[model samples]
Target chain A: METVDTLIIVFAVIAVVGSAAGAFLYDPPASPKDFVVTFTEEEHDVASEESGSVSGSTISDTVDVPVPMPNVTALELTVTMSPSNSPPVRANPANAVIIVKDPAGSEVGRKTITWASTESGAKSVDFDIAQQYLAGLPDSVDTRNLTAEEAETWAAGEFTNRTATGIWRVTVQISNPGTVPNEETFAISVSGTATHYHGQARLETGPISGAA
Target chain B: MVKTQAAMGTPEGERGAWSSRTGFILAAVGSAVGLGNIWRFPFSAAEGGGAAFIFIYLVLLLLIGLPIMFAELAIGRKARLNPIGSFRKLTEGNRLWVGAGVLFVGVSLFIISWYSVIAGWVMRYAFGSVVGSYFDDPAGYFTDVQTGMDALGYHIVVMVLTASALAIGVSKGIERVATIMMPILFTLAVFIAVYVGFLSGSGEGYSFMFAPDFSEVDGSTVRSAAGQALFSLSLGQGAILTYASYLDKKESLTTNGTIISIADTGVAILGGLMVLPALAAFGLLTGENAQGGAGALFIGLANAFSNMGIAGYFVGTAFFVSLFFAAFTSAISLLEVSVSFVVDQWNVPRKKAALLMGLIAYSGGIIAAVDGEIMGFMSGSWTDAILILGALLISIFVGYVMKDAIDELDRGGIRGVGRITIAMTRTVVPIILIVLLVLAIKVEIVDQYFASIDLFGW
Candidate 1:
């Protein structure tokens, strides 16, 4: 009987220890690291191109010049054209043709902007292209006035390959078609930033220049 | 097989007998329904798989948990000893088989030590709710009371109370207390559940709880449900074994186990209804730390109460009181196991055993409660490790070494449906327990598997 009692006592001790050990096996440590991330937004500037003065005279005098602008990295550009609010009546293409050129004079990216009227009583157009194509463009030749045929050729180039940025030009021809005061050609530079995953470039234009 | 009529002596003049079948069931249910039901179950369900987890947990409780509970009870009754001596007798005095019972008692004591600390927190919260101290800053109130000397003081107070109950012996003290407390617990839970149901926009909370999200069903969820089922049933620990020792031979062990398991599972389900819906109604169900640890329940309920205004205070007090009762009853069982060891083995008087056990538990609990890190380690890592290993040993002893006696004890008294349950309890249940015991040891898999569930907003 004493042996039995001694055995029971031993068993009780073992039982307590065994249960503690078993429970420890199931309870693991909690993680100490935090694995959450947060993001915030910041402000920046937009890129644009500058056109030089049109020095030619007479109805047939035509000058082909490239606009100057900063190098854009990865950006989608859009351009729109409508009769200027302060303009004499002018007949022109309702859409603006956008062309991007690399420093090596190769066509990299291009798009056409269509005019749409918003509730603010303003007609505007826009185009979207990858910022990478704009980043390769030359610093000079931001905007130019193009003839109808040139716009068609630019459209073909837009579909084929990207334009390099050495000398890029956009041309807008204004014709007095309606019974209104006549005016010379009008030039406007579309401005925006070229943004990429790595960074972005800000481009600004000089003032708009015109030709008669 | 040599059958010996071994009279494992109790302390002189001590009558530690269960009064009736009702007494045994109520006491067992008291041990079974605890923080595991209110504090653990809803959070587990929310973290496991919402409604799908509830479904799987219920099935596992009925299938795996119920039968094992019956087997544990039957073994205890047959041996008529504490867990340590029961296994020894079941194995016809094989010393190795006694390891399972020893492990169980150790785990129970460890659990009792820290469990008292938590019970103290409940008591403190109960008081705070009455005085409106929690309303000012509920979260801060919980943090302040849950750590440091205040927690230690309450833990000692609760531990002493539990020891006192056990010292009065089983039938008159533990059973009688449970008889009164269990109904109040159930009634309080049901009342809270119904009251929460009437609150506006409670329908959404109900839908979230009852509506099954089939997408969440996976192997990890199933395993967690299984673990919760076993834990909530109070299996493997000698609580049931100790309770069963007082049971009369004429009682149908199978029938009693089924009834107790059903009652325990019912309380757990009602507890989920009480908590989860309230959490949903209050929109406190989201957040990374929303469903981990005991703090989750306090935080969630406090948030719910603050939103509900003055009525929240009365309801909160009632809830914590019920929680206190549930925890108090379970703690009594834990201390009783230690007392039984002293009385059965050393012929120590019940009162003396209770005093010794109480002192030891109080000291351990004070160490835990004063140091937050120690309390976490005791409750988290220590409890899990001991329980899993102890359960494994118990499963092996019941399934393999003492199969004959287990079968014999399962056969007598139970009839009709009870007899069928006995057959399943003897064979199928033991096999499932063995499998779970093995799976629980693959610690990496279990941890990674449970971690992968996106339930805690992870």
Candidate 2:
């Protein structure tokens, strides 16, 4: 009985002490971390199918850019559209709008470019989103006045540990279709790179029907 | 303290004794492992404090759950009767003690009344998986069938199945079913756990289940851990006691009790390993996507399976079928507690008692199935209160009041430590149960319910 009593006391003490030690010493699961994630640049080409009477018509294509897909700190989209005609046309103005949406279906960035069409090989427009966000800061809110952490947060802008991480959609819509003497063919290629944090486990979603 | 004079061997009035020690252990294990393990444990651990919650829960199970389990078994084997009969016989027909027995039996009946309804839901899920009925929209399917006439129909189906097993008698029915189903349940659970481990991002499930974040621990966490230990073990309900009553005296209570405890806990851990990882892989483990209780299992996991294409069909079928076996075994034990009482108290045959009690429980289940709120209310704080109160009183009865209870515990190859167990039961067991009981009422009922009404306008 005495041995049993002593054993019981020892066991109870161990349980109590072990629990307190574990409570204080135990480490939590790691939080989603912030890191610069780079995406390999890829060009996707889309051709306009319309030939004659191409005015008032639009041609558009959406592409999926593969990146670490969340908390994007830096992104650059370069759109190059080249149009060719049997007889070259002059001053055929065309408007191009580039749209980017995150996995949550929230539109995060948009850029518009307009140019006069010529028989040139290619016309290029560049959208550097991070610089745009940095430039968008309020005039009165000076970066020098901010604390180090605050400045870092401000620099990260809308990309600080954003939870939306799966798929990113980039769509380019070209309007005011070509006015060539005979027929016109426009080839547009959209390419970009994105930097984001890498920590959270990527979602393993199955391919959806009709998704490219 | 009047000692019970019933013989140490098998008593005359037992419904039926377990044919072998293995059958008894398997049946006891079956009773302990149920929907609580599969549906509730993973989420509870996730919500409580992950591994910290598991640690506290294991401590409570060792210190408190096991002792009470031993006491219940000892009392049952010694008296060799139903809870009411056992109490009356042990206490020399003391009315107050006899009423305690009635409460134990009543708690079993109360639990089963709604328990069968949920068991019915498991059945529907099992069948639904085979037919691929819920694959299209899991959440919508659960909502459509979880209540009303559909729930009632499944509820009746579950009740009839449970009653049929009971009516077949104990050794042939309950033991036979447990012997066969327990192994199958283990195999299916292990198979799923292994299969899901190969999936990408499943490591998050491991972290979610096992990473200890002590900051989440609080008063409610401790209370929840303690309550879960008792609830998961199926202690404080007459089911354990009732099952013990049919045991042969030569079988060691300590050995059987220990095995049952370990087996039950193992099944719960396996369930966590299986479900949590699969949920993480499919990106369904997020707070926004994952729900609590049955919704976590039925809706979230169901949706994950639907996305898995052809493979989901086989795995989903295996998962729900194992769950059905687990639920069915437990529902049988719950029904048996009342059936045993009727058989012993009224000199009724086992078949008739099972039928009568089954019909009554079936009717109560219909009401639960129809309303759903009734099921919630019955399974909530009030049930916790009853279960805790019963355990507290039994500990007191065995430790201080009942004569030769330690002697009974020492029987059947248990040589020593009976006195130590009784001492702990008298002191630490009651104290812990009292704390848990108060916390159960304060947190579950008062805090949840009265806060809404604001009766005192505080």
Candidate 3:
């Protein structure tokens, strides 16, 4: 009986050790492949005429910027209205305006980005621009230069909007610069929304000129 | 001849005196020094207010933990019974008072099921560290090896080892194991602390650990400190009660309790020295995403070992091996609580009681191991809640119910300083513990008040 007890004890120890090994060895299955959106920037020169149209011109311009997206995922494009060259304006109750549309040119989602500051003086604001907002834009949209029509769409979308994909144009018209100085230097920041296959989301942000 | 005869028959009252004073101290210290000292204490310190937490913890240890520990030992020695039996015997066969002992066993068994699983993780990591499996790709290796069947298996191995040791009974088993293991545990802890202290660019980790980030102090920090004081000393659990049952009346409970508390706290501080410095030395402390969970010791230390070159392998192995011993000793105490109860109460043979209790613990442990959430709740929230409640209950029993017997035990001990300390322990300690219990309940309010202050840059 003693020997049997000893043997059982030894077997129990081995079984415990074996199970630990199994736990360490187990791995979850890999996720399935899915389409991903990636952002890239290409610079284009704007004709002088495209820069002058304020509220009704159809001119388009191109701007060069670095791509922030590292992986491919679905895309979301948004347009904001803010003052020219101002410190990045937050979508707040005072001056918050955003418009988003889907690929079929239908409004999908819209919200105001609120500006908040931390004790350390760090500031952040969020706004949503739908994928459909990219539809109905001219074949070539120069983010560097904005026309009156684009500006109106940017403002109107700040309240209402549409959706499209491929190349989308965003225009910013700052209404108030707040306590921050150098309002003209502030450019509208554009970002893309994409969800990777692994359930991680990617976002890209860049400055867009407010020349129009 | 005396040793052999004593071993042959378990004497009801005096059969279990430790072979030496050092054996008792080390055994008690072994119970006190555990994963709580190494991982949990430092995390609490870091989260609570670093240096501020240390100060509060030290105060709590002196004010609350030491007295309750002394009371527990005195009760056990006087009754010459296991926690349940001791309480019943002390209350003159009052059955209701046995709840304190029962609660200790329940909490201990619950703790052992999961604690052994962690011990198994340490065992696996000890081997893996030697092989440099983690050295090649530490993060990926930890993530891969950390969960599932491997963890469960190792937990069971350690649990059975603990149970087998307890089955041999106290003198021949617990005393002998503690004597051999405690020195090794201390040596490794000190060696790691010294080695990590001297590493280049380790100043930050050292400062983070020892320099006291005073900013972390607040009311919640104090409550956590008090809770840790209870845990680090193994106060509320009947382990002390059971261990003290083996003590001869001649032993000084106050002196022993102080020594154990100091040794436990010393090792805990050293463990922080070992972990924080190594982490800081490697600059692995950055990026919030890199912060790990309770398994941080296994994952973090593995990552550190992989980076330490060849020396890292040996040191890492030594650290885990020491941890295995430390954990094994405590695990034995936990298993003994239930097994001893069964043997003492049911009149079952020692070996049979061990097997039954071991089987029950093993099954419960398996369930906990598979479900991380359950394991977490048992170890984290449940253990704290139960320990605090247990400590308060034990205090009331010893302070009021056994006050006269306890006073006589305290008075019979050695000379001048010891006598004064005992008087203070009997009177002052109980009052302070009651206050601590009340303060602990309002800890949330204190935490918010402290958070509003900008001290220590927290």
Worst 10 residues of 1 chain B by lDDT: B2-11
The TM-score of candidate 1 is 0.66
True contacts kept of each: 0.00, 0.00, 0.09
Candidates in descending DockQ order: 3, 2, 1
Q: Report lDDT (Cα) of residue B457, candidate 2.
A: 45
The CA lDDT at B65 in model 1 is: 77
Q: Fill in the DockQ of model 3.
A: 0.06
A1-212: candidate 2 lDDT, tens digit per residue: 44334533554454345434433543212222344433444446655645645576677778775442334555676766666553346346667677876655667678776656653466777777665545656676654576533443444433332333356677878776566543455566656655543222111222111112
The residue-by-residue lDDT of candidate 3 on B118-202, one tens digit each, is: 7787788788878876675443444334345666667667776887777776777788899999999999888988898788877
Task: Tell me candidate 2's TM-score on chain B.
Answer: 0.95
Q: After superposition, which runs of candidate 2 have C-alpha atoms over 4 Å from their true positions?
A: A1-212, B1-14, B288-291, B452-458
Q: Candidate 1, DockQ to 2 decimals? A: 0.01
TM-score of predicted chain B, candidate 1:
0.90
**TM-score of every candidate:** 0.66, 0.69, 0.66
Share of native interface contacts present in candidate 3: 0.09
Candidate 2, residue B416: the lDDT equals 77
Assess candidate 2 and give its TM-score to the true structure: 0.69
